[model samples]
Target chain A: MNVGELIERLNRIGALRYEDWRAWVIEESGNSNPTREDVNAAALAWLKDKADGSIWLDPEEEQMLGEFLENVVPKHFDGSVVDALAFLERYGPEIASKDVADLKTYLNSPTGLAMIEKFNGHTGEQIGEMSHFFQQESNQDLSGYQVLRELEGPESVGNTSGSLLAAVTGIMPQQPDTAASAAPAPEAAHAQSAPPALMA
Target chain B: MQELPLAQTHELELIVDRRNRAVLLHRGPELEDYLWAQFDPEHNGLTLFTEKGEPRNLGLAIPKSFSDKLARASTLKLISVSERLHAGRPRQISLLQTTEAFS
Candidate 1:
């Protein structure tokens, strides 16, 4: 079933079996129908929506969606996956969550399957294809993010710099300050505050 | 200005040094003292560097407001990271307040 049909089915029954959702996704986003590329694009778009807060997500649901996109969804694809978790972790608050639950609901449906198929292939045989595709996209996104940062007005530069977390990941904790290394006392003090809470 | 209960399952504590215009994350005592990452006010950028000065990119869990605030402050210290839970699961409202009051 295509996303459209799947939506229709969902509306009629108010719910769907996993099998039904999968079948519809397979039919709609199959090798011959929507094509793996189309499915992949849709999946990325959906993820972008999730990242930018264009979709509805509760906190738990948001956490789960971040995990699925970063871990499970990448397992199905072949190329190096963009770190969806990192993006969400850093910029989650900036991206506005939708009032409706449609995005979360759709992700749990066959539409998700169609997106995963971009990398996993028909039977999970295709690998690297989706990963490589995403890797390229991530590179482009990073470049764009950098360009945007450079273009920001002086008044907004600080906020944009803070947004580095959203555009990139893997390097956190390291402040760009060389002087921080010279001052260990504040660092220790910060650590001191955490233990009591962490221990609890 | 607000006191928030820390999350039991939180992996890291986010702190900001407004005097230095930096952001840092405090891991548990079991971790190294220098494992924290800070935000660079000059560059308005945060890059993860280990205690050994090795550079890499690591993921962090911080509310968008916290990061945004880092750019505006000179010495705000993050006292504790807190969250409110729903259905036994944590919500997204993780709070990172400074030691000094914000007027």
Candidate 2:
């Protein structure tokens, strides 16, 4: 969509934020706030700049690295274009003969360890602790009643309190009978109403 | 339409993961919001967050309940709940899943 149409749609959905607009302009054009007349021209200029490799380190390398990470790596290991660019910025010159083992060696270094720690709040040792906790939890079986209790709605808090009161006072709450309260399906209702001869 | 900024006109699409029952919203390339069912293994209790990143309650009931039904399916489109429910809230979040979603 054109810029005008796009803006109207965003406003309708309440997704527009002033800060976001400002950031986009600053990134696209060096201008913090372009005049209304100049905004469209700035955008077109930004598009042209993006097409050439002026913003990124090298557009060709960026695309190649991004594609390799996305296609060859496991789905979970695949990262954003920003992530790829960051990697290239650090190791572009170091990537001699494009050896995978060299990259693996770099990952084992102190810098890589720090990056991994930042990825999650876990070190190599803490991840083990987390795995153990999940392993123990997964082994425990949940009873059907327990599952239902877990699934109870917000209104059940009051209902549970009322039931506790009834238990203490030796008076039963006006609860519907479990069997009788169950509603039959339409097909079942039709079958039940059929004559005995028809059933035979 | 009047000339508006690109950021102003961006649309957000919401989806729910079939497995793990996480709610995800996408606006542009970045800005992914995840709402998920968090089960406390220690207490055997369940708590669902309405949105990811500094979780806060949107004061809606159905999103918590419907999160269970969204399990084991492809990402379904999440439609906003009633606007009246979100009227006074600062963020104006609508949190409910629609029957239709993209596979």
Candidate 3:
């Protein structure tokens, strides 16, 4: 089925939350819901179950489920789930049964949380696409660089410079010094302390 | 150059210090640092840098009131680099932008 139908099915199955959807999908499909590795399997099984005269997730329902799974679920799933699954995938059995709490703690750190957040809204395929882009971008490959080069003409250059200056300075035009100081004694000291060579 | 998403409500600006080789983004003082920090610098998704080595400022400018929600809900950051020419040598710079939403 399509994404919308799949999402509707998932919602009807009371799998609106990430945890609930994951549990239901895993339990029903009997396939590990460790990562995207199991999405296709779970989806097929889910479709089969609907068709088997058991739980009925019709075409529209299946489409909803797919859309939700592909888009909304990825965007909103708690960071811990993504980290836990990734940890399991990357570190193997060492993190296979790791608790959500531990995974959460790992995800709270600057680097860990950053990665989790970055990958939160993307499927394995989307991540792969991003990775491919990065690889190509990093390689400074000719074709991509050419595209970039074409995008950087005179107008683009001026606009970029304007943007850079705005970003760095917080976009406020520098104001002339006008306000009276609470204490003027420090002014002489400040000037005297300035780099002597520059003053000279 | 990506438009500053927050520009409608906030008077946001980008500043570059060619001498210091640093780039900065400024929104009015009412917004919190954490809110601004949400903008990531790595992805080039938000901000674009010039090839001539200068920073570009990009972002949304929402009212100061929404600062708390932004910090809690999103990962927004200055992202991307674009290169351009300055005089003869290639100048390379970074971009910073804002993202804001209307109530």
Top-scoring candidate (lDDT): 1
Q: What is the per-residue lDDT of model 2 for residues B1-103, given as tens digits with 9 covering 90 to 100?
A: 3322212222221122223322221122322233333332222222223333343222112233333433332222222211111101011122222232111
Q: Which ten residues in a row have the lowest lDDT in candidate 3 chain A?
A: A191-200
lDDT of 3 at A119: 42
Which lDDT values do the candidates have, in the order given? Answer: 0.31, 0.28, 0.30
lDDT (tens digit, per residue) of candidate 3 on A1-200: 32233334344554322233344555556854244335434544444455444445455544543443343334445323333323223232233344432443444567554444444423222211222243222211111111122221111111222343222212323311221111111111011111111100
**Arranged by lDDT, best first:** 1, 3, 2
The better candidate by TM-score, 1 or 3, is 3
- Residues B37-86, candidate 3, lDDT per residue (tens digit)? 22332222233333333433344222222222222322222222212210
After superposition, candidate 2 runs with Cα above 4 Å error = A1-106, A117-200, B1-10, B21-23, B28-65, B69-103
> Residue by residue across A44-159, what tens digits does model 2's lDDT show?
34333543564432565334333334342223223332222223332333443444324445555787545433332243222112233332222112211111122222111111
**lDDT-superior candidate, 1 or 2:** 1
RMSD for each of the candidates: 19.6, 23.3, 22.5
Q: Residue A136 CA error for candidate 3 (Å)?
A: 28
Q: What is the CAPRI rating of model 2's predicted complex?
A: incorrect
Model 3 misplacement above 4 A: A1-9, A15-18, A25-33, A52-200, B1-35, B38-103
Single-chain TM-score of chain A, each candidate: 0.25, 0.21, 0.22
